[model samples]
Target: MLAKVLEEPERGEFFARREDEAHSLVNLLQAILDYASLSPSLKRRFTSALIRLSSKSGRFPDCMVLEEVTRLGEDPVAAGSFGEVWKGSFYSEVIAMKVLKVYERSNVKELLKRFSAEIIIWRQLSHPNLIPFYGVYYLNASKTRICLISPWMQNGNVVQYLRREPDIERSYLMLDIARGLEYLHSGKPGIVHGDLKGENILITSSRRACLTDFGLASARDSELIMSSSTPNARVTGTLRWQAPELLNYEAENTRSTFASDVYSFGCVGYEIYSGEIPFHEVKSDYYVMQSVTRGARPPRPPLSLCQTRGLDDTLWAILQSCWLKDAAARPTAEYLVSRLRAMPRNAEEKTTPAAHGWDRLTRSRLSHSLVDHPLSCSAKVVQEWKQLSLFEDWEA
Candidate 1:
């Protein structure tokens, strides 16, 4: 199963929708033929069939590949909303790249504003724990891309780690995140990580984790700017991790502060210990608003959750403080990082054996990039990346 998944992850088990359920995915005929690199005749036969299918569908598998491949210097390992994230190979050295999806954008004028702002925002800060952007590149006349050739974040995300390795050093991981956030929020301009959740954070190849995706980040005074636009572009962020204010749909009509971020961060903290969706008991955003506004509080963190995860009363209290309903009661990122540093020493986790999807090749093939990979990462990310062999070099 491991070998098969690595060789043909698209057809392997554990996909959200069954193969028959998704007919539009570019067929794997060509990739299969390429993997059979030893057989020229097989490749030729597959090529003929591929050509015929492309003629009918008006798309080719290889045609979907990234163009520049320069700054990244290699092909994409994972792809997402703005573009493909390629593995960078800079003058023999390898790093990662985030390339823009040209075809995905319709309004170039609007895209330029958002894209430029995102680039400038990332450039303003630097930390060993933050996902760093090497720089931006423009190829030809209309193409633009952001290359982040930093230390590759290898463990995937914290959310998935919670479920699979619920015993991982939570205090250690949280401290790493807090320290990075402290740097971001206490800077000269004081950047507030507008979107703080599990999915956006990536664990490094070095076993160290860092916060990422500051596209929505801003300073204390401008935190409210997140919902500054009407109806907003693409809902601003993931709904499950949204604060009560955001879950209420008054985003554009009201204001947000570091307090709002605190509320959201609380949910993120729960994800660390429970390894479950912050409010999995609820159904949807409307359900969330009904429950949280009516005082539906998450369960209290247990001593076991803290002990097993290498956290303590102080750090747990701090995590919960980030999630208080009233923004005023929530701790600032700077404070959270400070308190997190006081975590108690705990043993490392004993991870369960890999799941079906986390076995090999399937582990590296993240199903859809639009699932959101910023502002910490989703709860299931590390598990999925494990299945895809994304952390091929990392031990369990």
Candidate 2:
């Protein structure tokens, strides 16, 4: 029976068609193993073939598996286009597990490819400003659900952390973000963070901003952005933070260049300074796309807005230069960091909390009103409750 199963032309043909189909014959082989007491040599041959087939099948190595991980709760700490992030504990360490959403069998193959690609890229990156990746594993026995594990940022995403600790300096946050980008763009074949925005930036317990989510990242040499023929090259990042050239959809602009990242960095600056997303007033992403393609930008925050935030005019000027219609005119990430470093620090910033008194008052009132409420309170409020001394640590 084992010989017949192995010798079947149709079985061999099916397995040869795609590596993904190799597992289809596993059940048949298992049944044969139970019925026929195979000889040691035959068993060895079968084991060797199974090992070769496993490697070709794209299963992550055994080292990547988490023998046990305890989910904290049903609520996800964060959510994104690809998955929801839950806080979990593995080997006594708290980690964030991003569970990819389920898809039809037809699309599962492509999703798995993407998940594997993300892991490969993330594992190779090691930097202080880049979020640390732990590993990835299958969530269940069936192996249909995959989860990416990474260190949990206690402070959460940049925007959320900022809203909570309004006293933190915007320049410091911006500087951290710039440094992360500088690292990504400085390597031999620099990496392009295709999707960069406030949400993608996380704040570590040390109050440092770290970059994460490399699902769309690509090596400069690979030039995933350079080829317009590829669907991913054309549309992958958030429209609000995307460079005008990227929005133009021109064959040349379709290539994601470091210049495009600089443009998105500018939008991040706008978010940090104004406390609002780029084009927050705009009703639709389509409108923002149209406006950007025409050389229109999010209206500059008034000088008063900058002053109120304790931000120098030079920083605002840098943002303007970043949004220059010509991609070549935009300053490189390295230049932006240097310019930001040269800006003078505010005297009041040393003593004053970064947030205005009114903003503090408003938040305090909201917190008080929601103190007794459970479901009515937002995730941020719940987080605040959990970390009662969070503000004290920030002040320290």
Taking all chains together, each candidate's TM-score versus the true structure is 0.60, 0.70
Q: lDDT for each of the candidates?
A: 0.51, 0.65
lDDT of 1 by residue, 304-373 (tens): 7656755556656676666677767678877776565444352221132111111123113322211222
Q: Model 1 reaches what TM-score against the true structure?
A: 0.60
* 118 Cα displacement, candidate 2 (Å): 1.6
Which pairs clash in model 2? 167-354, 225-255, 225-256, 226-255
Whose lDDT is greatest here? 2
Off by over 4 Å in 2: 1-63, 222-233, 250-253, 346-396
Model 2 scores worst on lDDT over the 10 consecutive residues at 354-363
